[model samples]
Target: MADVRIIGLDIAKSVFQLHGVDDAGATVLQKRLTRARLLPFFEKLPPCLIGVEACATSHFWARELTKLGHEVKLMPAQYVKPYVKRQKNDMADAEAIAEAVTRPSMRFVGPKSPDEQSAMMLHKVRLMLTRQLIMITNATRAHMAEFGLIAPVGRGGVDRLLAIIDDQTDERIPAQARSCLQMLVAQLRLVKLQILDNDRQVLTLARSTELGRRLMEVPGIGPLVASALVACVPDPSMFRCGRNMAAWLGLVPKQNSSGGKERLGSITKAGNRYLRQMLFAGAMAVIRRAMQGTRRTWLIRLLERRKPKVAAMALANKNARIAWAMMMSGEGYREPMAIAA
Candidate 1:
């Protein structure tokens, strides 16, 4: 094992496969270890380079292995897929990771700290609760519409529907149906409260870190977006530039360029979907405000030439780049000069 210079670990809940290579790029170790045996084996092994595919628990293992003096590199699974040489299996995947890690051009994902992971978990729970809230609201609306009861839309409309459900004198909804719908209403209200609580926590997280506070100064990046970015991305220096960071978020256009001809399609929509979605939503909000404000910003100009959705995407991409720059430079966002309408 002393001859081993690099190792690729294919980790699972119970069993793990390892592929180790020597300085000469020859296989030195191929072994399988159970969850209980995994750490002890590594603890005994001398310090070496370890590569792992990023997944749910990859960061946890990476942190643990690093504590044992191993240099751990977390690579995106998609990037490691091309290195597979044969039929897919845990062993093959481990071998592929071992090979990929030594490549000069390979990309690596930064392992997230426990606190960052905790923040991401908070965001995930809030997202789940928000989805539940939407589901309950839709179910309530559907049930009420069956009895000729209709409301406009949004929270105010939902509240109006709830009011009708509560009115005992209203003959539109039968008592039995009203009781069932009230149950949905109660769930909806509870979810809203839970989401509000999540928002407060996210706000606190955003204020806790200097980087988070700087991120919030960017247009369209509220407490939620800022917090997620801080949690998901621990090292901004991994990206060479703002555009690379934007590309990492999959905001760049997909290209089909060959020869000298260039053909670009829609945004790749890869990387962290939550971050992309958050940025797009924030861009829409910014566009809405820009439309009402007296400033003639770049987004407003884009809106004149392209559809609103297209413009929103462009704005999202720009915001991602801006956010990356802010994170890298340790600087606050500066408002660009805009012409008066």
Candidate 2:
């Protein structure tokens, strides 16, 4: 450990590989350490630059390493991929990270705070539970339909079934079918309760933050969307402009350019899927209100002439830009120009 200046750590659950370089970009140390020995190894070394990919647990370690006085850089995995040499291995990957972090133009991800990570984990749990509940509900409905009994679409149908089960004199449903419906209704109720709890958690988290408060001023950005945005984007300054923010969120269209002609395709859909989905959902909500004359201006007028889904996506992109502006400018959401709507 001859005054290591830069160290690249290839992290894993049990074992970690380290590639250390001196001030002159010469390999000074290459070592493997178990999870238990990682901190101890770094504890003996003077504070230096450490680099890791922005994957699972990266932020946690970044925060930990920062606390230990090391400068940590979390690079996106894609950005480091090009640096990989002819063969890819833990040692090679560690070396690539070492090399990548030394570049003057390298961009690194800002490590998310504990609170942001917690909110993100809650959102993930809520999404998983909601998907499971939907699957159960659909399976129950399909099973019922096979017996010449059709369950109506949407939650209303589930409510109707629950009411029938509670009724003392309803004979339309057979006993066995009633039993199954009762079971499903019970499960649905449990899931709905969990969803309410998750929503409350999201709201509670959102209400305690300045960014969340500002985001609330934006139309259609409720507790969930605000919290997700806050969690996903730890540092808005990472983006140079609103368009950079939109591109980071994968709201921008993919471009295919050849010769002198340029064509743009659908959104890249490359970043956080949960955040993108929440933004799209918020946009759809806004579009619904816009459709009802809530805002009859240029954007709305243009939307009226295009497919609703397309308009919704366009609105989502606009909302991403506005969000970026609000974050960067330290201002609340403002209505777009009257003509632009």
Query: In terms of lDDT, which candidate is strongest?
Result: 1
Deviation of model 1 at 192, angstroms: 0.6
Write down the TM-score of every candidate: 0.95, 0.91
Which pairs, if any, clash in model 1?
none
Local accuracy of candidate 1 as per-residue lDDT tens digits, 1-341: 89999999999999999999999999999999999999999999999999999997999999999999999999999999999987999999999999999999999999988899999999999989989988898898888888888899878999899999889898888889988988887888889899999899999999999999999998899999999999888898899988888898898899999999999999998899998999999999988888888766677788889988888888888988888888888888888863232
Off by over 4 Å in 1: 338-341
Error of 2 at 76 (Å): 1.4
Model 2 stretches astray by more than 4 angstroms: 162-183, 337-341
Clashing pairs in 2: none
The TM-score of predicted model 1 comes to 0.95
How do the residues 249-317 of candidate 2 rate in per-residue lDDT, one tens digit apiece? 788889998998999998899778888889889888988887888657765887869887778778788
All models: lDDT?
Answer: 0.91, 0.86
